[model samples]
Target: MKRRSLIAAAIAAPAALAAPRVARAQAQHNWKLVTSVPRGLPGPGVSALRWAERITQMSGGEIRVQVFGAGELVAPFGTQEAVESGTAEAYHGSGSWFSGRDIAHSFFTAAPFGLTFDEMHAWMYYGGGQELLNEFTNDRNLQIFIGGGSGVQTAGWFKNEVKSLDDLKGVNFRAAGLYGEVLRKVGVNPVSIPPGEIFAALQSGTLDGAEWVGPANDLAFGFENVAGYMYAPSPVEIYGGIEFGINLDAWQALTDAQRTMVEAVSEAEANRSSADTFHANLQAYEKLNAAPDLVIDTFPDDVWQALKDASREVIDEVKDTSDFHRRFVEAYYAYARKSTEYKRYYDTPFLVERESFFS
Candidate 1:
């Protein structure tokens, strides 16, 4: 009887040990990811689709993310609310879309005459930008990640050239984030329009001008078909970034291995998306320049100076809103000031010299 009992106990122990392995192999996570751009568009749109694929590949089929373009599952501007409300598991979008919630949110996406792509990355990853962002999002039970960015954007597309500061007055323009606020101070009427609607608005004359993204995206949407002039030097959105916000509860549910995979993948997408947009813009610019009817022009010196002054005033106005906003602006400008010196000496000089060759 003792021998028989020993044999049964040994068999039961092995079976119990094997059960956990079997369950782990079968584990799967199906998540829904929504973006601010429509599916299949370049830039953030392509980045969103590729990011979802990377997550699936890295997880070895243990995780699968379903991608939805803007307004597919939720309105483009409603992405954050969807994630927070548990209607969606994750959101791939721009933080500036929610600037209404907190004007400081614009710092995460872009700022007028603010950080470049590399500078913003340095600040977010090394200089405590992410911590401040976390402090803001954590209060609302969400976690944020930098998903993608376009390094720089064109000023906008306009029906007529802007030759002086007076040209801006009373013009109905579509600008995003604090850019709109800066325009407001300068006597321009700035409205916030979604990406898909800008073309229609421009065609119908509802908008006198609109700042979308850079060459690749703007060209892709055929803004040239409606607007005759392409303006240069984006004072706002020097580096336009897209963000990924995940539900805190959903994030906490990930296993240590799964979480590690997510972190690594997010970093990869951030770099890849920015690089992709940069190259695509370069190619698109070549095509745009060849078009005879499209005239590319720069904002005149006086107009640029006026914009610079107004941008400062707009930023200063945020200081009186809250102590938290005050700290955020202070830190952002501190970093921008330090980075500008390096850029002026290095990047600015090289680009100026290089331009002479082409000219």
Candidate 2:
């Protein structure tokens, strides 16, 4: 009986010790995520809220994220600093918001006339984009995840029609990222305004034109009521990509399983948000087109050609900003060229053929 009791005691002790560790591993984490978008706004804002909900659900409530919109926890452009200072665990915003820190940051958001939606996704996930981003953020003591995107955006809302390149000259345009640089090259004065302030700028004649997300977000912001002309094929951001920037220390504090869960949910949100924005934009476009006061148009051929030329110049100038910037730009363009070629052969022709039948 004494021998049996000794063996049972040893087994029970080990089990008891292991049980606490398991419970600790499954402990709950309540994290705060600050966004560069206003709460409930379409596209990035809505996506952030959904991402937080998903993280909670996927982690079985072991990890709960409380999302704060622009200016709630920090100003719209202050998200990066907030994360870096450990004031917030994470941030959801476009990488372009940090371009002032390094122009190369714009590559992660969008490049003027750069990669399309599918191509951007391919480059970021399969190509070296993610690795480059990780390196960049790591230097700042933060980690980045490609969170969400507004597939392809509209040109902008214009108070008047833009019939030629001359119309763009001296126009007070509200632009961001590389698009602002490209617009400047073509003689437009790019106004730096936060997303929330854009509507008021336009209404008060502070801005001649502005490009927000797509029809859904634009309509929600009442751009249609302020501007008469809505243009298509935004040359600024072919694809608007948003990122999840988390503090390195906070991220490392998570268990391996928790880290994996965060990454998996972020990628899932990227796809889900893009699709949601696309569908919403489609519905909004249908409604906007029916409005008699609004005029939907595409840029004239000459204007588009000039913008294209200016975009090339802007790209060349930007690549020389720094060694890292040069490398990123070169890699991006190389991948973009390859993807463009593929689309030319496959996607472009298929779309043209399909449209011919419809017309």
Candidate 3:
């Protein structure tokens, strides 16, 4: 009986190995995607994994991707460089990670006075934002796609009331990219620390406030437990949208079929992440408000105006240095201004009245 079983197993092995060429090709073409987010088993970490799964399946398992998060394969801050150098083939993370490349990359994550999730998508998909973004990367041999967009964000969690413009003086805040520069202009001491460190910074008195993503993320990081004041209308970012970018060399090597699959999945998942975050924020608002000692607040008129002006100054500083930046921003604001005009006339009545909403 043992000899008969061994003979049958030997016979079955050949059947399983019928496709030798396909197996060899698949083994040779596996790729990797680096992410700054650390949690990898599921949820957000699974994003890169999902992209991997779809690409592999679509390419008949010839295109496998290994998703490594945060420090699994490289240091958190070094992902962009790693991908650019082909030390890793790709990266699935925030656009703000590459702010050093150009400040406009940070706009995809958060910009002072940016748009809502749906609005940005409309702008990106139909209003020509994606094409303009391509133009930004055209010279650098880089390609980016919106991996996710966290909708309208909360202003921030704070230890004290920010009732007037003067309150920001010397405030030690954790922020990033040009927003940091803009905040600096207002006399706030803006600092960049990894996202993993924000909760501890807030708890240990190392930070006066923080403008990390929004409600879904704020609650995820347990901000509701520490910061007593919750500010709204997160003008610096009505959205916290994350972008996934890859080195152009890797992208060019992909077969046309493989490229299409990656683009479609990344674009679709971006919409999913944005809408999911939008829903999560609404639910988190209730949870945040329910906690003890938590006060919901808003910046006064003068404070808002000062923030706007400071943000404008930062923009003026960067505009001419890169024509792509100048042209892209002009196109976006043209649509934005048009949207504002329409919203003012049509939606303000059912929405917040402009006098109350703006002033």
Most TM-score-accurate candidate: 1
lDDT of 3 by residue, 1-359 (tens): 34333322432332332345544454435677888887463335766677777777866766777888789888976887788788887788778777787778877877766666766788887788876776667346567777777666677778888888888899899877777887889899998887789889999989999988777778889887778888887776755777777777677665444566777888877877666666777888789888888888787898788888998888777677677778866776677778877777777675666667777
lDDT of each: 0.83, 0.81, 0.74
TM-score of candidate 3 relative to the true fold: 0.84
Clashing pairs in 3: none
Q: Give one digit per residue, the lDDT tens place, for model 1 in 269-304.
A: 889999998999999999999988999989889888
lDDT of 3 at 227: 83
> Once superposed on the true structure, which residue ranges of model 1 sit more than 4 Å away at CA?
1-27, 357-359
The residue ranges of model 2 lying beyond 4 angstroms of the native Cα positions read 1-27
- TM-score per candidate, chains pooled: 0.89, 0.88, 0.84
Best by lDDT: 1
Number of clashing pairs per prediction, in order: 0, 0, 0
Predicted candidate 2 versus true structure: per-residue lDDT over 44-74, tens digit per residue:
7778888889888877787889999889989
Error of 3 at 217 (Å): 1.8
